[model samples]
Target: MASPTTAPARDASREALTDSPPVDGARAPGRRARMPLRGHLRELRTRSLWVAVGLAVGALLGWALYDPLLALLTRPLHLAASTEHRDIALNFTALGAPLDIRLKVSLFLAVLVTCPWWLYQVWAFITPGLTARERRYAVGFLGAAVPLFLGGGALAWWVLPHAVNILASFAPEGTSQLVNAQDYLTFVMRLVLAFGVAFVAPVLLVALNLAGVVRHEPLARGWRWAVLAAFVFAAVMTPTPDALTMVLVAAPICALYFAALGVAVWHDRQVDVRV
Candidate 1:
């Protein structure tokens, strides 16, 4: 019923209305992809299964290397024994202590040994949520995490003898120091794990920066507090009263925090320039 020119105008108006952004400048909604609940549950099961398999393999390998690992763990005790000239050796009070210690140690060692594989599984699970830039950052984080974790363990090894010596000093001059095998090994394993987590924590701070959850200024300004907290954390967690061991543990963490802050600042600069 309309004329040709009027019909064209009507079509143009309709197209404009459909094509325009929303009133508040928000983008028009598009069809979003969705996954069913069953699919999500299946994905979680697959990832969890892979991680469990990796842990099992690592634990098996650790159990296989039990003799060498035992020697490695006993060295600090030996060193302290030598310093005191007490000929002290680790003793098991319970019948099943030896086997139980190995099992527990293997479980802890599995986390360290299978780190890369389990970390990849985590990355894969989250890959859908990450942008390309975030993926690249993730690669860097993984690279840094492994070495930092190993370094922390090595530092713990160095600190252990000192810690053992300090703790032994508390005994009276003539008392025989019989170290409990289970308790000592558990303490040592937990110490290493704590240090490993502490070392890798800076990676998380950098991640927050990259994700724009935090900025560099606040982190940099918080340096004094970071240093105090680091020392306090080290003192509480090290199981040693020696200031040297606490400082050794705290110093690297502070260094890593500043280093991560520098990276965040660089990233922010690049973004500002791009903008």
Candidate 2:
């Protein structure tokens, strides 16, 4: 019923109204599209702050326990020397070696002590980005990882004294073993880290399976190869060229591999049901 000019103006008004954003002052549609990026950045900053705090706390604790920690770490060396009436003397080749060892030891202790808090912060930061199912899987993985890693570390601690004894036995019969402090610390740290990380292999496999990257059938089929690889890894990681040490490291990894296979199989079945 309107005239042509008036009709054009009315249509233009309607188009403008339709194009305008909502009046409620909530996020604009375009702005909402960017929310994820902004949220991710915010989370990154928060996680960084938390990680810094955890590291600081760890450093302080490390400093406080430095002496006792050093003693505990060196107990294996002392025990190894008990039977031979020889002392394990630590020599510093470099003038700054003592200070350097202290600093390195402090950092190492800090990382070990703060691992739980650091891991939790990382998990918390990434949790919001994961699906509910993924979050559940992550929680389970972390729960299992903590104990598995700690058990591995404990095993290393137990076997270390024996390993030290075995290695020290090879020293010339009448000579006192003079071990470099830095070298001894480095050796122990390596063993602890190797075993601890090896125990987490199952968790990694399970996570891959849950993410649908790998399924159980392939893992089962490759079981032989996996066993061989685990032994090879153990051989490489063992500080001493001893068969027993290799077996000790390999056995646990092999067990973890089989466990991972079971988890992967279970996950595959769940995925099939959902599909």
TM-score of each: 0.78, 0.78
In order, candidate lDDTs are 0.83, 0.81
lDDT of 2 by residue, 179-211 (tens): 988889889898887778888878888888887
lDDT of 1 by residue, 1-275 (tens): 76889988998999888766544324333221145668767887899999999999999999999889999889888888888877678999999999998898788789888988999888877765555565677789889988998998888778778878878777788778888998898799887878888899899998998888988999989989999989988887666755787888899999998999899999889878999
Worst 10 residues of 1 by lDDT: 24-33
- For model 2, the superposed segments whose C-alpha errors exceed 4 Å read 1-39, 231-249
For candidate 1, the C-alpha RMSD (Å) to the true structure equals 6.6
lDDT of 1 at 202: 92
